[model samples]
Target: MDKALRGKFGKLLARYRVTKGKGFRLADHDPADTAGLDYSKAEARELLARGTALLAEEQSKLYAQDQWSVLLLLQAMDAAGKDGTIKHVMSGVNPQGCDVFSFKAPHAEELDHDFLWRHVRRLPARGHIGIHNRSWYEEVLVVRVHKEILARQKLPDAVRGKRLFDRRLEDIAAFERYLANQGTAIVKVFLHISRKEQKKRFLERIDHPEKNWKFSSRDVAERGYWEDYMQAYETAIRATAAPHAPWYVVPADNKWFTRLVVAGALLATMGSLDLAFPTLPAEEKAKLAEARAKLVAEKD
Candidate 1:
């Protein structure tokens, strides 16, 4: 993308970003808000294609340079299209340079350590991209909404009180800052979808034989806590959003637009880093030239 388009894309994504002190309120953003986009469906697809191509190039450069890492955190209510967003936006990236981790219920071994321990161990090394379907923020989000779960984590009394959620948010901010300082760029996204939209998706899953396996009793039970989840999301995002690790509250009722916004946000973030493929060493260049000369001279 050209400079003008890049700037435009950045500004568009910024509309949904929750930076420090901005304070995210889910109610303020409509899950179906496509007013910021003037493009048609086809145009949105084109934009996503351009972004996917740019992301591929950037990922290659990132791998070659081995100087930086990226972490993409996608958090959402059920049926908000997190899986589809990941599948479409990252389709062009080399699998070798990417790692996708889905954090579900904590395994026994995982619970043995700090909340961030499992995720910390799974962070991408330099020159790689790590995508978390659900992340450590779940500790504050789900656990905060369901206080019983938090109590069961066996955390110290220091973090168990009326201000417990605030303390966890503080810890999250500190953790992200540390990651940023250590050469990781964080792009956190909350796929914001309306209750009605979620209901529609759930109905589809129930009615379609192919999608029947996607629905479960838990999903229905969780639907009852929609307001609680939104509140938790607002609290966590407001407390943790930072310059280096910003949160984007994406309107996800429209899957196509969500992909475009996500792809655009990633392009802008990586482009801002000014990534470039490393130049070969003088000796390596010489060896390559010699090898080329030998191949040219041989009968083909």
Candidate 2:
């Protein structure tokens, strides 16, 4: 990305980035907000293409450097565009250097371990990027909204009190801090879609034959607890938001804007790492020169 675009994205990111969640209110963020950008859908798509190209370039450097890794946590309500955002924003990235994990309800084995165990096992290796469609935060968000899900975890009575969510948030923050200390950059995004928009999308899924497979009765059931989920999200964001693991409350009503912000957030995160291709040592450089001479000497 050019410096001008980078600057524009930086400013846009600043508007939504929450490093400290004190006094943060989800209601304060307008789901329809586009940061006042009047770009048409085509214009936004072109800009996203540029951003993804730059992201691919940056990912190559990150892989060659083989030092730091990136973990992106995307959390949102049903039909909030998390899947589309990942598909579009990461379109240009090298698949070998990136991994995407979509976390649904826990299975029997997953329930046997602590909340973070399953997620920890799926973490990215060094010099790679891991995208979690819905991550461990679900332990706080979904589990909090639906208390029965927490009961299914079968935790000891001592840890299953009113402060359970708080303890989980603390653990999450500490875990993220540990990852940051170990050369991982964490970017958490909450796709803030309005209830009205969600209803419209749900109806679209019901009406369109191609989208029918995406619809689920469970998704509609969860809609009844919308307010509860919002509160859970707000609390979790407040507790876990930190310098090491910041949250971008991206507006999801507009898919184009959502994709742009997500791309910008990633670009800004990787840009902050100052990633670059590794420099060859003097010995390796000499060996490469010899290999090149041997190859040039051969008649092809």
Candidate 3:
């Protein structure tokens, strides 16, 4: 992607990027803010197609160099289009070079270790992309909202309550900073969707037989804690967002626009890495030329 192309969408990302010490308040960001963007669904589709092509090319270089890795963690409320964002934004990347992990309630075994242990284990190796649908932040978001879940973690009394949330936030910040230092670029995306939009999606899921499987009563129950979840997300983003691991609060009301922003942002981030295919040494190039000549002669 050229700098000029990236700059256009970069503005969209900059508008939503939550910088550390900026006193981020989710209430201030509208889920439908498409300021300065006058693209139709068709236009967004075209933009996404271009962005994904660039992303695929960048990912190929990333794999060939085998130097750096990328981790994209997407967090959102239910029906906020997290799945759609990942599927559409990453559609062009080679599956072999990318992996997606969806985190749900922790299994009994996962609870035995630190909250981040499971997530850290899933980090992508060098020269690949890792996508976390829901991530370790659930410890701070869901668990914090529903306090009873925190008691199950069996933490020492000294680290319970606000202390626990604060400590976990610190751990996340340090963890991301360390990953950045170690050549793993991190992009955290929060798909901001309105409660009304969620309800609409949920009803659609119920009304359509093909989508019925996606509707769950649990999602409905959680809707009652909308305020709690919002506060938790706002606090978590504010505490953990840093230069190395910035958070992009993308508007989720328009799925097409969301996909475009996500794809464009990812491409811009990976492009900054200056990833390139590995160069062969002079001797290796000479040997390859000789081998190619021999193969051509044999074929003739």
Candidate 4:
């Protein structure tokens, strides 16, 4: 919340932010990178606590201003810490001012419409922050990785081809730009987790009874297509990264570090919005003064 801490976070955001995707390589980013921060897990936790507190303050202003909204998109492979990041980074925010949506396989009705239909309808209203666990990017990620899924979409013959992914990416970029113009600040994050780290997490889930429910057999099946997913992510990022909808490739091997970066990214985005609590007009101030006088004269 202080100027010094905010500056530190600003620098961290610059390190991972991708506004232009030209020459971007997923391999260029280290999954274990901490941006030279040597803080222990406890130290990181304390920092995150502060960040969340500041975020809550900023969120209050955003809510009261009742104009700008924020959309945070988290995209990653299985076991990449998306859920944990959301839970920890947004802990201090008021639930009424925030909305979280997790997108899985599309339902029959969802598939009936275009890919972005379901997600578009779930967007947050003005004065709220919307978090998407996995979003329309899945059309280019999962659907791209698995061609069979695309066939199930029932697209017209004219729009079904090898170039469809590129076309979809262009549409996504335009959609995000439109949202940005309409007062929604967009921040997209990719939890960059290594294959080794993901495997370890999967094993932990299998071994821990408490985490068993979080484990899905399909998760392991998808692991076999790790490279495919990575390629899809790289392509999507390259196509859609823009000033209005920047992407943060946050490292996920270290959950603490990942959480800190996520918190910082959201903090930076909300901070840039110049959010402030609305000021009362002259008439409203007079009304409030009258109400205060009446309250003072009344019994406790």
Report the lDDT tens digits of candidate 1 across residue range 108-216. Answer: 8887788889999999999999999999899888887788886557788875788877877898899999999999999999999999999999999999999999899
| Pairs that collide, model 1 | none
Off by over 4 Å in 1: none
C-alpha TM-scores of all predictions = 0.94, 0.98, 0.97, 0.98
Clashes of each: 0, 0, 0, 0
TM-score, predicted candidate 2 vs. hidden true structure: 0.98
Question: Ten-residue segment with the worst summed lDDT in candidate 1?
Answer: 17-26
Cand. 1 Cα-lDDT: 0.88
Instruction: Write candidate 4's Cα lDDT for 70-177 as tens digits.
Output: 999999989999999999999999999999999989999999999999999989999999999999999999999998997789899998877999999999999999
Over the stretch 1-300, how does candidate 2's per-residue lDDT look in tens digits? Answer: 579889989989999999998999999999999999999988999999999999999999999999999999999999999999999999999999999999989999999999999999999999999999999999998888778887789899988888888888999999999999999999999999999999999999999999999999999999999999999999989998998899999999999999999999999999999898888999999999999999999998
Model 3 lDDT tens row, 1-300: 767668877877888877684678899999987866878878888888888888999999999999999999999999999998988999999999999999988888888988999998899999999999999899889989988997778777866665878888888898888999999999999999999999999999999999999999999999999999999999999898888898998999889888888887788789889898999999999999999999988944
lDDT of 4: 0.94
TM-score of candidate 3 on Cα atoms, chains taken together: 0.97
Per the 3 Å backbone cut-off, how many clashing residue pairs does candidate 1 have? 0
**Number of the candidate with higher TM-score, 1 or 3:** 3
Deviation from native of the Cα of residue 131 in model 1, angstroms:
0.3
Residue 33 displacement in candidate 2 (angstroms): 0.1
